[model samples]
Target: MSLTAAADPMLPEPFGILRKRRELSDTFTLELEPLGGHRKFAFRPGQFNMLYVFGVGEIPISISGDPDDDGPLVHTIRAVGTVSDALRTMEPGGAVGVRGPFGSAWPVESAEGRDVVLVTGGVGLAPMRPVIYHVLTNRQRYGKVVILYGARTPEDVLFRKQLEQWRSRFDLFVDVSVDRATGRWRGRVGVVTKLIERAGFDPHDAVAFVCGPEVMMRFSVQALNERGVADERIYLSMERNMKCAVGFCGHCQFGGQFVCKDGPVFRFDAIRDIFSVWEV
Candidate 1:
């Protein structure tokens, strides 16, 4: 209906920046809406979009907005490189080109009737936010939702207010920890994996989704295994050097898989040995 063929999926669509809010000093969220009223870009919880900043460049960024929020598409970006820094400077009404909502997603639908454990570190929470949104939207579909987040420091936390609100909900559980604390900060101080022991969930009935630095994800798998969760039940969002958000480019190759096409989200058991190799 949109007059685009799946084969030629590289065309970037026009979008208008509707709003922006700084979540942390270096990271912010951009709210964008389709230009010319194109059919809303629909996607599952863990998908990503290739965002192009006019003349600067493009990069693969996860869609952080709620899947049910029909108002605008949201992306949380940190000012790390040239393109992202350029994007961070954009104001309301800015124009951008978006080319995706690609890659494999977290097994949200399959987690129905079972407990879901989501763990993220640093700005990695952006990709995991949609899963939290999905479960909260369909509260009765899943058994329990456990969220564990860790940041570099107290001031490094992203989505602070939203995290508080989720914690306030009686239906879900949220545990946030900081790697280090500054003045007056007294929350849990350690890596996110340490928070797993305190999280309430049934290993036998639970599915895990982890995203963060490679080290964090690697250790998270060990922690989940220690907690008795099966390998196939643990999913991870892998981050690699990705020049192209689609499979055409080989920049995101990890072992025999291409992160852009095969996954950004993968079952841990499926790729455990591949990623575990020291040379890999």
Candidate 2:
């Protein structure tokens, strides 16, 4: 009944590729600056863009660069599908069609003055990157900032250098864990949930933002609950089969809502009931 797509939100504009770096064996981080006479892409913390590769098709990739940048719009994508693989093979000076900085975002401003807890699993850290930068840049506004990250293996970790830099800051606390570890791995080996036991924060004054596999979020919420965080203060980013970035296609529908428009970011209390429903 309700439509969220704009009259021509389907149109994709050309963006010039500025840089591309291989992040993992199958993943890449692309830096794109809008080329159609526009200098910047206005975006918030959790928004995403519909990246189109000429004839291959399009996919929704979350914005991974700082929202403060004007020229380069960065997106880190995994080469797991046809469209994405094509995008990955593109070189600098290549072209990509971009549609949006759509969907809701993490409540970064509301987090001001409160102790913030950021929990991420695997590539989930990409979407949470902007929020982390915001907190660090405005370090004086918030209280304690804690980051707990988990990956499939030590080699699977994203933003390794940035994580270390953040860890070096005396005011920020970062803990990383891997599900599988090799002989050379010296970090904690387990799920992200394990880090919660050692997490330092006032459960009553803390707000947490979690993103990852839905199963990971499920378990994270349980752990946060045991730590005394209320459902309303816990947030999550949901993934659905988004076809039309504007929500015309029903591929991204969850329950009675469209993840494209309603959210990719939502409070845990708003979607907890539907989270366990496979059909949602």
Lowest lDDT sum, 10 consecutive residues, model 2, at 1-10
**How close is every model to the real structure, measured as TM-score?**
0.96, 0.96
User: For model 2, what is the C-alpha lDDT against the true structure?
Assistant: 0.91
Q: What is the RMSD of candidate 2?
A: 2.8
Collision count of model 1 = 0
Give the whole-model CA lDDT for all candidates, comma-separated: 0.91, 0.91
Off by over 4 Å in 1: 1-7
Question: Against the correct fold, how does model 2 do in TM-score?
Answer: 0.96
lDDT of 1 by residue, 1-280 (tens): 5665656788888899989999999999999888887456688888999999998988889999898877689999989999999999999989999988899999888999999999999999999999998889898999889999999999999899999999999998999999998988888999999999879999988999999999998899999999999999999998888877777788888899999988999998779879888755
Q: Please write out the lDDT profile of model 2 over residues 1-280, one tens digit for every residue.
A: 7765455789888898989999888888999877766577789999999999998999999999888767688999988899999998999999999999899999999999999999999889999999987887889999999999999998899999899999999999999999999769999999999898789999999999999998899999999999999999999999998889787898998897788998999998888888888766
Q: What is the C-alpha RMSD of each candidate to the true structure, in Å?
A: 2.4, 2.8
